[model samples]
Target: MIEEQGIIIALDGEFAEVRTQRRSACGGCVANGACGTSLIERLFGRRVTQLRALNEVRAGVGERVLVGISEAGLLSAALAVYLVPILGLVLGALVGTWMNGLLLNRSLDGSMADLPSVIGGLIGFLLALLWLRGYSAGSSKRPEHQVVILQRLH
Candidate 1:
């Protein structure tokens, strides 16, 4: 099971709204200094993403809780969130390359003047980012907690 720690923000009957912290894998990225993601995350601080879960534990507002989902669920969720954008990027690049080949009436050299290629790449990357945001927002369902809560710290 994949476990995440969060704080309960609201309780709506049998459902609890928990806000989870967003983490990036860029902590050890070699391009951390040049990566826009690292810069943005630092500027914005930790992202508080809300998720709805079963209120079986009777958690209340401001209570810290741990949510867990099955390993299979986590893998599937990640694939959906990540695969589409990658497909879009590859498709866009291919289209751009094809269009360039036809427009110039000749094959493009391995030159840096391919504006379409650059634009397509950017568009593909942005599309993926946008899709990820929506995917994350909608993927949160009634997650099952695998670990039993022995006691509340506070």
Candidate 2:
């Protein structure tokens, strides 16, 4: 399990809204100065993240607590969130190029295909987002995807 310490700010039945500050894990890395994330962090400074965690430890509002989620769950969620849309975009562009060739009988200009490609890419991206909406809704109900309060810190 991956864990972080946070303070519960609100309670809603069995869940607690925990607020955690973003910390730089790359602080010790030698390449920190060359990393895009490090640059962004330096530019924007740190930000806070609010998450809903299962109050299995019965932690109350204003209490410090340890929240956790399974590493496998986090990996899978990250993969889906990043990969699906990109795959859709590439596949859509390929299909659009094929359609352009088919419709224009392999026109010499080739530039005509650009419009179709853009339109196809947009459509594909929108479709992927729609699919993700449903996927997230279903996954939200699974215990593995949920963040849980591991223990009260103080």
Candidate 3:
């Protein structure tokens, strides 16, 4: 499980909104003085992210707590969001290129070598986005996707 510590700022039924600072790698790295990350961090200090976590600890406002989500759930979500689109794009482009060759009986050196690929890529990206939207809507109701408050801080 990936755990984070935050302070509860608001409560709504079974959920609590916790505010936590988003940390960057520059803070603990030796390249802090020469890295571009340090420059970016200076421009945008430490931004806080507000997350809604399931209130399993029955915590109240202004209270610190630890919340976590499962690693398997995180990995699956990441794959769905990142890999699906790329795979779709590659497969669609291949299909388009193959179709072009099969139809024209010519190599991809033609004048419209890229049109089919472009159209196929766009269609694949759109389809992947639509599938992602539906998947997220269905997964939101699953407990594995939620970060639940596990411990209340002093």
Candidate 4:
């Protein structure tokens, strides 16, 4: 489980809206100074992330608490968000490439297959985004899918 400290900002029935500050983990990395991520970090700095957490601790507004989320859940979310689109992109490109060969062979003219490939990739990316939207909306209703407040903090 990945854990962080947050302050409860609001409550809704069984959940608490905890505001956690987004701190860059890249600062401690050896490649920080050499990467474009450093430039992005410089531009974005720290931001607050408000998340709904399972309020097992019954933490109230203005109370600090420790929140934890499953690492496996995070990893799966990463895989779905990143890999699915890439897989779609590759599949779409392959289909476009196949179409390019077939269409060009039949007509013996244009190699303007690049357009099809780009269009296919864009469609795949959009589909992945739609899937992600559905998953997030559905997952919000499941307690196990959300961050959990482990304990009240000082």
- Tell me how candidate 2 scores on lDDT: 0.87
Q: Is candidate 1 or candidate 4 better by lDDT?
A: 4
- Give the local distance difference test score of model 4: 0.82
For every model shown, what is its TM-score relative to the native structure?
Answer: 0.55, 0.88, 0.83, 0.81
Best by TM-score: 2
Q: Which residue runs of candidate 2 sit more than 4 Å off their true CA positions?
A: 30-37, 108-110
After the best TM-score superposition of candidate 1, give how far the Cα of residue 150 lies from its true spot, in angstroms: 11
Position 85, candidate 4: lDDT = 82
CA lDDT scores, all candidates in order: 0.71, 0.87, 0.86, 0.82
The predicted structure with the larger lDDT, 1 or 2, is 2
Q: Give lDDT tens digits, candidate 1, residues 1-154.
A: 6667888888788777788896677878889758888888888887778877776778788988877668876776778667877887877777777777788867656675576776776787778888788866666542422222222335
Writing each residue's lDDT as its tens digit, candidate 2 over 74-101 gives 8878888999899888778777777878
Candidate 3, residues 50-146, lDDT tens digits: the string is: 9889998899999999888899888889999999999888878877778777887876666767987777887888888899999888877788888
Clashes of each: 0, 0, 0, 0
Total clashes for model 2: 0
Sliding window of 10 residues with minimal summed lDDT for model 3: 104-113
